[model samples]
Target: MIPELAPAKACAAKVLIADDEPNIVVSLEFMMKREGFEVLVARDGRAALEAIRREHPRLVLLDATMPGMSGFDVCEAVRADADVRSTCIVMLTAKGRETDMARGVGAGADAYVTKPFSTRDLVQQVKDMLAKDTAARALATGSAGAGELPKDMPA
Candidate 1:
């Protein structure tokens, strides 16, 4: 539990952390909870996709590699679906190559985070992406004022 609110953090956006590694999952869950986001988990790509369809979370921290149906596949599926296309995706994995990042981007991932990532950086990045996404949604819906970014978000 995060005792104090962190700057740039939002109110409990549901986020899915999909990874097969137990240790990584545990750490991610704890970190997300501390950041005031409701964390969900899936051990494999299939389960991750199922959860995404069912929960429609605000964000998904997807592992690039899994036993079956890689994260690339999952991201592509999410992008193909109009309903879930707006969902923010952050691909997390050990593959840090330029090609891997390109593949993730082509698959519609909003961000790509490599393994051994700093938790603080991850949290900040999550906050920033979620904020931008919220602003975009407001603009899309015509709910925000012409001058005001959603929730006073900086330009």
Candidate 2:
């Protein structure tokens, strides 16, 4: 029998939830924390950008319709900044039109989620992104073998 491999450790990646809605903030916070992410909450778009610049979270769940700055603005700024361009951004929006989706992608958002989305799917997506990021970093640093396949890789 092959030796047992150690179970994957809970990810310590940082995630920022940028939304003005109190209920959404609380629910997303709870879900992310339960999945072992260190969470930061930003109640406005400007605040979200500030938090991202200061804290440098690996992932952000950004609301599209925040006061002052839109999620598109935040995504564009993050993508433009070399220091934080690698940060994965998911644009959360009530606007589900194809144009809205195009706008989000144009602004450099890595993913887009509708307002009424599945928490399980979002959580899993976050987890997968974090895992992929970690593996990429490891590979970049030459710590992990190049032959190793990420768990989510298709056969």
Candidate 3:
């Protein structure tokens, strides 16, 4: 419910942020807005599940560690939900351990980025996710445009 990101004001593409730390959520919300993404914040995994049900954001940035319903649990819930399973998920955490990465992968996150990540990287990741989603939808709707097929389709 904090102030929305600036760039997001124009495009209005929604993004969900799940993290326990207030400062991290605030900073990411501001940065995502500056990069043109509407931002939603959930302080814990249960809140994140509710937001996903209500808002259905294009992407979710999930923190691996939280007081309740850890990121892994959240990810599992999302993956299980048919309505929001396709939502792009990027894990955020201070823990860079190899085992942690394995667990994140096991949880079915689409992408994983460590804490202290560069703002540029985060913005690019969002853009890439949106573009990928657009492409996927186009393909699913059989509307890759007239005289055009998906790049991977046999010519």
Which lDDT tens digits does candidate 2 get at residues 1-155?
A: 99999977544678999999999899999999887778999999899999999999989999999998998999999999998999999999999999999999999998999989988899999888777787988778777676775542222
How many clashes (backbone N, Cα, C below 3 Å) per candidate? 0, 0, 2
Q: Tell me which of candidates 1 and 3 scores higher on lDDT.
A: 1
lDDT of 3 at 95: 84
Each model's TM-score? Answer: 0.85, 0.85, 0.83
lDDT of 1 by residue, 24-46 (tens): 89988998888778889999999
> Candidate 1 — what's its lDDT?
0.88
What would the per-residue lDDT of candidate 3 be over residues 1-155, giving only the tens digit for each residue? 89866642234678999999888888889998887677899998889989988999888999988877899899999999999998889999988989999899899988888888886788788877877786888879877896553443211
Give me candidate 3's TM-score against the actual structure: 0.83
